[model samples]
Target: MNKIKNIGIGLLAVVALSMGSCSKDFLDEELTTKYSTEYFETAEGLEALTVSLYGNIRWHFGYEWAYGITLYGTDEFTNANDLTNEMWNTYDSRLGPIGATTSTGAANGNATSPNALWNEMYYGIASCNTIIANADKIDDEDVRNRCLAHAYFLRGYNYYRLTAQYGGVVLQTEPASGVVRNFTRSTEEECWAQVISDLRNAYDYFEGEVYTYGKGITWTKATAAHFLAKALLFRASERCDDWNSSYKQSDLEEAIDACSYAITARGGKLTDNYSDLYANWTGVDCDIEQLDEILMAAGHNADSSTSGRFGNRTYNYFTPQFSNFSGSWVKRGVWIGGMDFQRCRPTEYSYEVYDHVNDARMWKTFKTVYGVNNVADATAGIEAGDPGIVMILNTKDDHTYDSYTFGASKQAPNWTDDAGRLPEWTVGSRQTETSGSLTAETGQWVPNSLVLYQNGEYVASSFTSQPICNFFAGINKTDDGSRTAEKGDAHRDVTMARLAETFLVRAECYVRLGNYSSAMADINVVRARAEWKSGENRSYYSDGSQAFENNSLNTGSSAEKYIYSNLNMNTYYLSNPDLEVTTEASSLELTSFPSVLPDEDEAIMTAIGASSDYERALNFILDERSRELLGEWQRWETLSRTGTLITRAKAFNAEAAPNITAGKHELRPIPQTFIDGLLNDDGSNLTEAQKEAWQNPGY
Candidate 1:
């Protein structure tokens, strides 16, 4: 971060660089000329600045910081066992006002610090201020209005995030041209009011018209309305209890109305298939930048040349170390999914919230199978296409296999029943080992299996290795197999706002308004999309099939390919007997509030002490949000706004539960650099007590 006399000055220094026209990359812009006030007053300079704001949007969604700030320390995710970025997830004494100074320091530096986000967002605000102040220089009315609209939306978007993370930060709407240190905090209410006002201005300028540039990555009327609804929802939430009583009802109504414009009025219908929204393969049909459901995204190009320094690294997190297993059957980089960064592992609560039996999302969103990739494993009758290890996410005893014969010869006698069995080895108990002939045979069944984990517990295995961070379930949504290199640029655009979240936002409003039936109706709309339709192949998955097809480039590789190329892949189970009761759409819908939370979910709600009906309803919405939007960067704000951060963290997040405090942990401490660089508004530096007073309570 650039040190300055004040925080605003540090933010303004980057405004000149952002006034350049965009290059081939949507996020790459270089300053071509020296800074000048007169140059920015020109039409070309102003338009160029407006274009740069699109690139600036990438900072919020592109890198590891995206997950660190939102997903970490929340119930949806915890640090992997092997992960070093523990400050954010653990919320220990290290998560202080100074912020993380390096990747492996006390914390994870900018990735997990409020410091970097604070500076970058204010820099963006400074840029937006420059554009909004000078966009009038453009003579064409249409261009001028467009520039203003973009500026307003970007400003509101940045402030919305800042306010959500650190309540009532120094609100600056004007561009700071020089160093100064007279800064003070505004009330949380004032910050939200300014954000709402800016968004409304952008909405009005759009005039219900939708314009998309850089594919579907740019802002539109729908995007403005969606965020407006979200901001209103935040203000209407319990976090605003001290000052929200007078306007809570109106804010909820307005939020619902804004959602109506974004969802129904403006062509904001969801994609027919949930897989379509996150088509991660490199097929021609995998284009997702212009999908109808995505209101806005952070765009990245397929061509790596223009993908900027860090091109959408959101794909690199949330993965387990599948390549580091005990057996020789699995290898790294041969498959299309990302490298095993293992920074954002899902919590036990994250997996339990899903309606695993009826919802297709559990099967669609998580990868539960790893195919044999090593050539040497072929001798065990486990060819490259064979299912190496299958994880059945069930707790029922009937779903398990009775016995297994491990390290046995090829001529092993009857490794359990051979008739009417599934495609591969099943998930079951190890009751007995069968006697077999000592000699091996060609093209005969043999065992060289790795351990298998079922429902976060190690149920059975051929290898004696213990299951830890290396065997947890992986989220399939950020799976990017299309990259040419192990750490290459990801082509998929980072989804920001989509129709699914819009529906959930409305459902939450109804819940707060005491309209349980209406809330369920809205909630069911998203759940219905998550349901597995009748007669659909249960074993197919889109990403897996594409990965297998890609693997076929190696000659004679026997990867399993899905028969239906058009439809995405499903769970590989042929006849999952336990899930038969609720495998279709109707079975997935909730009839009313408290419609039976899963066992783990019910336990968390209990720990949170939701004694009242409204309290339980809010907790239910939080669970639903995790099920639908786990790794999408929404958890922290959702928890914070509902004032459930402390309770939920205590209930579900093991790492953060013991260390997080109620009042202090709700909002991040204001960055220490910002606090240290301030003056007392009278040409004198702030005293130690003054600095302490300026920071958030407890930190």
Candidate 2:
């Protein structure tokens, strides 16, 4: 079943829990106020309610599975598996075509299936509404408002997700009364407007207090403002260039104001070490140095009985094989050499775009396997001869097919000529049987030929074979050596909304307004935090030598050469600082550019700078988001907002298919079942225009 159906069932269980109660003696007992509603009436009750809201954030979108599928499926850089293909087919992306399902009696609408992302989001919205309506009735004023704010933020956040995905949706401000609530859709504009207003209410109601989870139910001004900023920013992006749309430029201004408020209130700044922010999953356990950037994070405590099974532990999903050290039964056989598992792998495109040496993020993000040489090292001390072992390539079915064989030798070991080397071992037989007593000249004992069991029997010489490797098998020890912790998940965190994003958003707005100088300033602030050398700033033309002139910025051949050369050089230097720049340093130290450029050059420089700024902003935000929020379920949203869905689709399916057409594949189809169900029911109550409007394009 799909996640939505599962969550729906779970929600019913919660309702059942809410209804069942212990009976009270009516006549004999002394009069006492009922504590049923009172259970959620006090500060402690409200606090638990709010924690539940925060806890909901972790599973907001089933981030683990969604992120893996959408991020890889949308891009040209990564490949999709069967599960991802199933998701992609259901979504708007063209990487996979939709197929039929027997249970639903339709091509796509199994509400019980996990792909019903739409249903899951609304369920969250309903939960938030319950909290909001009930919290207001509490006697404690302070506790009441905090709970209300959290609920408002959650509802608004959920709506934000909904509008972004489905465009227009039925806005349920209050809890549904009946088990089956059939509601009509709201306009996309109406949905966003409601989202804005709800967030604004959260901001206003929680203004004075420092809201925190577990302490007491009070909305800290910071959390409210942060989400408020996010809502505004989303609105601004939608309406930035398209004035005819429901969004307005005022929204952008509001976003900037809200973000500014958050910055001032929290005293937060982006940290230099991007990796550390994610590595420290629990904000409390983070190093002192990293505390500045992490505004607020969902905390997961593994030891607590309250923690869920999938809660805090970084399982086999993201870690490399070596670090896990669990048994072979659970090992996925993919290990990060020394890195931590963050639950997603970077696409080749992501790795290529990064500055490997200076970025620091790349090293912390991925691990390179030493391949066969390392395997040889673990095998009996006898070094495997020529063509030093190449690490086995990890295939799509690596977890299912690959196996370790103990005794294999070259059939032409004693051959000196090419003709002799062309024996069975060199041709069809890449391996030879070795007896347990076969001793090398060095007196090292060879192990008996070890064959993996296939279909419950040993497969002696099968090359293209499928053998399941047990990840939970206690560490393997052979006479050769020992193999422990063979595979593990990677450890990296995905960052979604950070201070740098705010800066870049402001930079984009300033550039649009022709405020070049202001734009440059905002751009530089983010660069400074990234630890890019001050002198390497792209703002100025030369190292305090020549003042920038608008027309001159791109004119002279030397000037063009210098700028292009420097930009490329800087990118190379930043990405790979380990490499030496021998030739350029002799003539001029390229790193010594002036910090500020002249006002005249602001137009031209700002254009170039803005382009760089935008690319960096987009790339950094996406990359950082991928790195920090790897399993957090923001990939699809990021792709949708950025309009990179088709680009991602092409990248992800490069090996198997061609690029998908952009416009046709961007938005998801209104599920066929939803369309048919809606059309068949209650059309008699609708106007012609309303009915037409209800249908999605191409339906």
Candidate 3:
């Protein structure tokens, strides 16, 4: 990042050129003009600078501290198999002055956040102020309006993310013309007013115009409307239940209106298939861009040249631990996920939120099955240098058949169902103990067990639908083919705003407004889209028939099977199942455990009828978001804004439950280094006690 210097006109112009574009294609153009501040005071230069904002600001939103700090340690996630960021997960004060460094080297130097997101957001605000203070320089009418709109939208977005993180941030409306020493924290009301003003300006600029958006990747009127509603929703939420509050009756009305407009006017509706929303495998060859459900995304490319402008490091951070000490699991640009970088993993609660048999989203959201690489050999040991396949087995039904196994073949195994043998066949994907370990028991890796009713008795249940990897897929990079990639290797566009999240935002507002009926209606829309059945037509917007329901709940007895999987356990299963015997789910019925619709749901859904009105309403919305928007980087802000952070964290987040308190963690503490550097309006050095007084409530 540039030093904390003045936003000079010359430097701003160079920023416009140097940052370039964030398109699917690389910015390969060279500057042909000896341009200065005077030359930049034109339509083309302003447009160029607007594009540059996407490249620059994404560094804050797409990379580590910018987004990661808000993503991990929430109800949905914790550190995975590895102890990554244990301090943060445990809500230790290491998140603040415990490691505050004033040196530029304190941070990675790209976008400095010596303590939290202070330096980084200020850097973004500085650029936005530069564009906003000089937007009128453009001669063309449309050009002038568009430049101002983009500057306002970017500024509003940055402030929105900041307030959601650090609450009532330093509002800088003017350009940082010189070395700025004086810094005053704005009140939540004041900060929110500025956010509303900026987004309003952006929203008005794009009113009723043909949406010629920024390369189909940047924000438009649709984006502004969604954020405006989101900001208003936060304003009306418990975040504003504070001293000097400014939440008006119109807060709810305006939020509902704004969200309704985006839903109606924005073309970003839900896609037919839940799986399509997560097709981010640019490096794994599924290079499809999101259009139906996606409104705006931070653009990226497989070519790593411009990755610094828009790289998703957390993609690796959130992936499961897939690599060994030797790092043999990946190649640079082939794996869709990661290499043993288990920085963030789904908590047990995350996996439990979904109704797997009914919710197609569960299967789409996580990579549960993988091609087992028989690395020793596809067929182990025979006559030649290659471990050859045995053409024929002794006999199964006293019949002889050639076992075609040297290559891909779907021929069923000819081996008898021996009580002491592991089922053998070079075949299709199946559950395994580990990523590539030669064991049929998924319990060694994921908890793979079943609870079912046998022909006449309550008997041992064979497994189906056990969770393989937590959250999204980790890494399928086994280095077996020409296509091999490493952690965070894919440079696909990362989604930031989409319609499904908008639906959740609207639902949260409905619940807060005491419109329970409306909240449930909105939630049902998202849920109806997620449910799928086996043989339904895969047409547009069709919610297939329910594959899982209370088939025999009226009887209300343990005579029926209760759906069991790794989700029922808190730790990874240590032993594999006895594969010598197995039972099929087809022979038994699967029902939701502690069944919410039946008596079985009593264990987990304990507060069903006993919870307070607010608790019941909020928990439903939280679970719906968890079920629909898992690993989408919106959970922390949602809980914090709703004032449910403490309660939900204690209940769902195993890592942060012990350390998180009621008040202190609601807003992250402003870095002490930034506070110590500040001066009052009178230009005097602010003292420590004074700084503490101005800081967040408890820190």
Candidate 4:
């Protein structure tokens, strides 16, 4: 028998009593302790342990790039022409070609890199597991519970990210307890169950207001509920194959319930001015009052250490110069231009969705250089009458200038002679006239046409010069000179889980259940918000017909042509009233017209109110989701979950196969190293089933 010490080390250190080995009745002997699960006992110790869990939230370069690529790199949008490397390649929808080099999956040979995103997610899960296991031992209940809730939230979030990418993953709730830790992958249902349980637990512990870092604002129970609701909604959608097999209406009901809870609990309402939400990168001037819509955000600051510099760089890569910090370069002699990489360009499909005039979001999101800059200024010095010259002063004098053809008439303005003539000389003319040339001892002389002049003297001119104009018209710029701007900071925090989404979701549910009128009412709520005017306040069409009334334009051959054309005709018509139905315009035309497509409007309304309304509602929700959540990191998963990757592939004209075949590509491939290194030599003792199951479709 070993005697226990009276000194308090909590329950961590205890003596084990042996039955047969003891020689004396009350033998007292201290045996060296090998392993104990009771290491975290004190409040301070537990707090430190909990704080360590946050280290799991890392911002890896590859992970960030992948997330952005999977969403913005596809055909739905195009990269700005100037963006290059992985971004440009990906945006071209050459995934097989480029993903081979850039993607973290099996397409590349780097399926073994430790920094592969799969490893990061698992590592994050492990940290959460540690917090979950140790938090309960803390002396302070509040601290323990709070820490535990955060752990659960983080764990759920990580799992959500993982499951979204890899389908079902093994649910590990604790740290490795033995020399070997191996488990098979759980079913999608099982994984979602765990996620729901974790989120529910988190809700219980962190439902009340909790302060967030930087913003110092409290995330209420409503926020947690909103997150949970979004998760449930995604599950209900069952876009992922694993979940698709077992999707149920009950899941949608649960999602709706969660969203409703968030709305009611938080006194929920959409922020009145969506633009104000993202007006600044730092949260300094953000209206906390509008935070009800924003469930959570990865915070950023201008301070060096905390800023998301990479995110900012990525944003600058995609957005135009005028809408970003590069715009400030107008004051600097250096004029900024876009990458022209086509990686960040919005697709013709995406641009059409916006009701440009009424939607404030459109202007804030995109900048037509033609609209913002003086086209005359963009092609400034090259045009006739411009006093400036677009001469490239290079280090070495090895540049040449050629005469402009009739079609290419724009050229840099000729430099003035010593006499200070405005137009020094005309094209092809080298003679120095009295009025336009310098009068010197050696007769009239023109300033050296080949040399670049700064103040008045000739500087070296050696660099090549082309027309100083942007190929594409619109460009984005930073709000200020802040290079640390994030795309999230540029737009209104118009959340995806808004009241409109909920209504759409409910309408979808009702449609699925064949409840058309109920779904119609729900959808109408959203349309009403847009001010279409109903009943007594209803507006009529130009033909004195009610806007919603049926007509040949609404139900005939024109409707089919309109649907088939799908040329963003709405936006085109809005921007150009003179746009002939047959002829496409050379440039974007901004107009104020009243042209609305009856088919699309009727289809959307019918879908929202159809007997098969749920199906129609689903399509409508997805379409709207694409429109509303352009840069919100929703598209990839939405397409993946709904099995719409094929549709997207066709739309984007990607090199990928146009069918959603069941294979490794659907779920991302598990890194090969994880399989080789993390398993036993014989592979008999490892979680082989889980490992195999988690591999993506195309891998």
Candidate 5:
């Protein structure tokens, strides 16, 4: 095995191991190889064992699992054409169910068996169990408990993940012994009970111990409670079907207590700006765990090797196709990393989640515009007062190929172009909105080209619509050569858990508990942080309407057709030193967004008849989660957990809308390989009926 250098930043210790077979022999080889169980008792051995748990086993969450499975097949994102994992986004039955992955390769468009994720978690559990078993031989008390804490957290976290996805699993509490290992699928009740028991043990290990943190993303008491709280809450939700019990009140109260404790006692706080969450990734923030806001994260490094070097793969998959941008485009690295291989595009419903005019989260969570970086590259004769200087443009599909609409630019040309990185912006003519009239009113031209005028206004000049994953939020540029959409080896570490979500979690619990006022208070904290400061919201219309409807709002295709817009910045138009001379009001035609949703987005929520606080609170939390957590993973699971998978997927995800069904879609079938491999008590192969019993219903 190769050596694994421990990275202190973000608790991302990459584990190195030799490749082994997929059968039982592979397990024996890994557990009894170069380092034996005795190695775990020694100081160096114990440290190595703890670090290994965070290694390759964690890759499932880091690379494909989070990107292809967790984030897709939900309401927010739709599959790009030929996105082989289209089966996931479309719920294609040809996909595997409780067996080895179909010949198509990736289980659902990702990689192998249901056992792939299962193997990832259980492998970690095996190592953790080994550490827990040997902790008694350690000489140092603190080190011993700390080691145990790490193992317990890893096991609990994995088990919780398993129980959440597959109703039950073969719960292995001890280390795998030999080539021939015996295992049985535990009940959902048993699995969750074990998860809670393990986490409680971890938290109790250092009860009252002042929460200390280190470089890599460490499993802390708060981390334990954080996940424990989420698990408890998921169980209490309506989706936890065929549940072991029926006490929603007690289960919810227990969940609420866990959440409240996690919020207050955990010592994490929300990052000041939501955009900062994705910026400066890959252990850039060494003390990320120390901050009260982030309890945990899937650790990663700048290393992007297919053979064991850990890297954040989601950063690569989520980017859109903005590489054709040649002239004067400023500061968009995420788009140019490679081909605009749009894996998952936002659904029409997703675009509506944002209050584009007032909420900064929309821009922070997505990159709507790229500004002119080079003065020489700016279109020849382009003037400061160009119509769409800072706006995004799209070809109106409702009209001819040459016809287009100019959206109000989101960024003002305010910043200086320092070394070709600043002074850019985009307008809002493109987004997926399903209202048939809305769709008819806005679209880009074919052959996909944006038109620039002598005055610098931008407009699309084609009939074909661009791919939907064409707009992404993260811009962490990868190595110039590693630019494939399927392999975005962008070296950045994104947030998996932060305090903002915990607040939303608490708000969700409060709503379930009928604590509307407390729920509102919890929800308001997140809102106030995202609340529009005076200068941040840019309004484009002299019409004084709070709403910024699409081109349909215009009476004719005259010169004034697509002119209403806004930018929240006061000096947003100052791209060059000379443009500063113009008044901000003179550029009023360039701004369209900047309105507060003070009444819980009532205008839009009411339009949909979401009138009651109960109804609106759920919508508020759902929207807030998407606004804050989109593309950061956890979409499909959240919808599934809330029992809204079908309704939401049908409403938003265009590709999956026609195919998704609640019956078997909520739970992915157990990997078939594991089912066939199941052995009877007498060492004989289990019959097909026996294997069937181990699978989820319908699969």
Candidate 6:
């Protein structure tokens, strides 16, 4: 075993072992050599159990499983080339009460099932129960209250996730001692109440101070308050219409107040630079978790030997297969541009949500240029340190090349064709009408793949003008070039909640209560930060890779000098007088609800045909969330809580639209493994009718 350096080292191993080996029961076992009732009676045991709860958060949010459940089947993304887990995104008939299994009848956890999330959350809840049960053993009042607060926050956090996906779940507040299978489900209303109550108690216990028990990665008062506000918002939403009549107005008011408190609590504020929040390229030395914007995060140490089992494997999911098309610019051995797992591909609506002309976030969030640094590109008449593949998110009409005209319409050339070679010259239509008619335009990008250029002539790709599966835009948020191996886990912490999201949450509350002006006030804060400011180099970009190679941010001490000092931030820029055109916009703020949709975004507008002012404002807020928090692992729940999952998915997501139903697709079916193991009060197997009743509707 690795040496224990962090707070969660002691009990996490035992929790993992218990969860992996025991599959018949739900959170039924807790085994440790040093753990006993007598040992738990001491202060050290309570502290260890509390720390293990934090570690359990890491276990729950690890790798692609977390992404599959939260991000897939939403409007923002669809299954990429790698369709190993396509059922999650497609919402086909295969997504049912019975979870996925191998051909040999063994349980396959993350392929197409929510069992992994279910087990991990319940296991963490078991640990939280242990801490709450034994916190009184500590003699120090302050220490006892701190440990209790941590337990309360984590328990509420787990239940919050559980109820969001599985509407009504088995709520167990006490630690399970043995295998007992006659559990019943709690109402969704009861579950949300528990979440709100626990989080409120946790906030009161923390005494209005931000606390960090681990390596600056534990929950604080602000974290608790943020969740509390989120819970209130969810309860007040249409999802809880069955029971939230009396508490709707009060919930909205309290939620708005909680958002205000969370914003100022513990010196929390949105970071001045939006890129600074995700610039975690220095492994454990990176101060991302310590930033004032972060409310809570799952800690992962840089040293794999001690960072627990799944050490930030999320770096592989959002990245596209860059090595397939831009092989000369990116190599597997030299500079692997993220692992190309290609799990989550951005939809057409995802790219269309941004104001590509004014929003700097679109450029910073997605990689559009692949600079060559290899000798192989010379064979294709390209020199080193030149752009090999440049993606234009606009239509050909905006970037027509006179040399490449076809029939009445002219074709747009790649970045090499523009004589100006200006950095801001990459403007064009988001997606032109495919047949030059309004009826034929789906708003999806046409001719998605580019024809390569060799010696100033077009070279046909392998797909013959079709958009290849492996060739798509890459997401820059999860980029981590600091890993030593191509497929190794990352060293950065997984961000869960932040101040910007808190502001958005408050804005959402305001929208729900018919306060459109206040909602826009909060939305403008984030939008203003995303605007391209004066005196800023518009071409200089870093998706956590350039920042690591050149240390352009001046991150660390002078001793650690990384390679590629020549690849400074401005290496990709070209001196052009027209660069100032990008800053011509006065502001990115929206003064009122958008009544008319632009031609490019007509598809999304048609999908959500809002007739009321309230619907228009709410839908606009949802789009703003997509613009700000894409691939942040919160899309599915946001849509589900707002009761817009079906409408939005039907409108934007091509794969999920046909299979999604109104009432059936909102909540995930309870895991069939757990349902099959249920017993009656007489200790007999549950009847088939009873089993069907226990499952979610339409499962």
Best by TM-score, which number?
1
What is the C-alpha local distance difference test score of candidate 4? 0.40
User: What is the Å distance of residue 315 in model 2 from its true position?
Assistant: 5.2
Q: Can you write out model 3's per-residue Cα lDDT over 619-655, one digit (the tens) per residue?
A: 6677778777777667888888878777767876766
- TM-score of model 5 (CA atoms): 0.71
TM-score of each: 0.84, 0.59, 0.72, 0.61, 0.71, 0.82
In TM-score terms, candidate 3 sits at 0.72
> Top model by lDDT, which number?
1
Better of 1 and 5 by lDDT: 1
Q: What is candidate 1's local distance difference test score?
A: 0.66
Q: After superposition, how far is residue 211 of candidate 3 from its true place, in Å?
A: 4.9
Residue 122 C-alpha lDDT in model 2: 65
lDDT of each: 0.66, 0.39, 0.51, 0.40, 0.51, 0.64
Candidate 1 ranges beyond 4 A from true positions = 1-13, 16-37, 101-111, 280-286, 303-306, 376-379, 396-468, 544-586, 594-604
> Can you give the lDDT of residue 473 in candidate 3?
31
Of 1 and 3, the candidate ranking higher by lDDT: 1
C-alpha lDDT of residue 92 in model 6? 78
Candidate 5 whole-model C-alpha lDDT, 0 to 1: 0.51
Residue range 437-486, candidate 6, lDDT tens digits:
11111222121123222233322222111232445566767676566555
**What is candidate 1's lDDT per residue for 442-486, written digit by digit as tens?**
222322222233333533322222223444567877666555566
Candidate 5 segments exceeding 4 Å error: 1-33, 41-44, 98-113, 207-214, 244-247, 266-269, 280-290, 303-309, 324-339, 371-488, 534-616
lDDT of 2 by residue, 1-699 (tens): 000111123443332222221011101122222334445445555445554555444343223334433444443223212122333433433322133344424323421232354555665576566677677567778777777777787778778767766566667786655444456677666777888998898887775635543321223565667667666666555322343244546776676677777666657466654433442222222242124444444333212221332232223233222222211111122221121232233333433333333333333333221111122234333232211111111212113222333223311112112221110111011111111111112322221111123233323222211121111111000000001222211111222345565565565555444455665566555544433232331111111001111112234543332222211001222122234422121111112112332222222233224245444344434443443344344566566666655554454334323534555444444443443334323333444454456544442
- What ranking of all candidate models by TM-score puts the best one first? 1, 6, 3, 5, 4, 2
Error of 6 at 621 (Å): 0.9
Candidate 2 ranges beyond 4 A from true positions = 1-47, 61-64, 68-70, 80-116, 180-182, 215-219, 238-246, 280-292, 304-345, 369-496, 512-516, 532-633, 647-659, 670-699
lDDT of 4 by residue, 1-699 (tens): 111111121222211111111111111222222324444344554444444333333232212343343554343554342333332224223333224343433333432132254555565565566667776567677778877877787788778777776666667787655445555567666777777777877788884665443232233455556667666666765464344445566766776677677656655455543333342222222353235555654323333323332222333334332322211111110012222223344543454444533333443344321111211233223322111211122111222212211112222122222222222322211111111211112222121122222343223211112222112223232222222112221111112234455555655556555566665666544443342112211100010011112222334533332222111101111122222322111211112111222233333334234233344445555655554455555566666665555455445423233432444334554455544445443444346564444444454
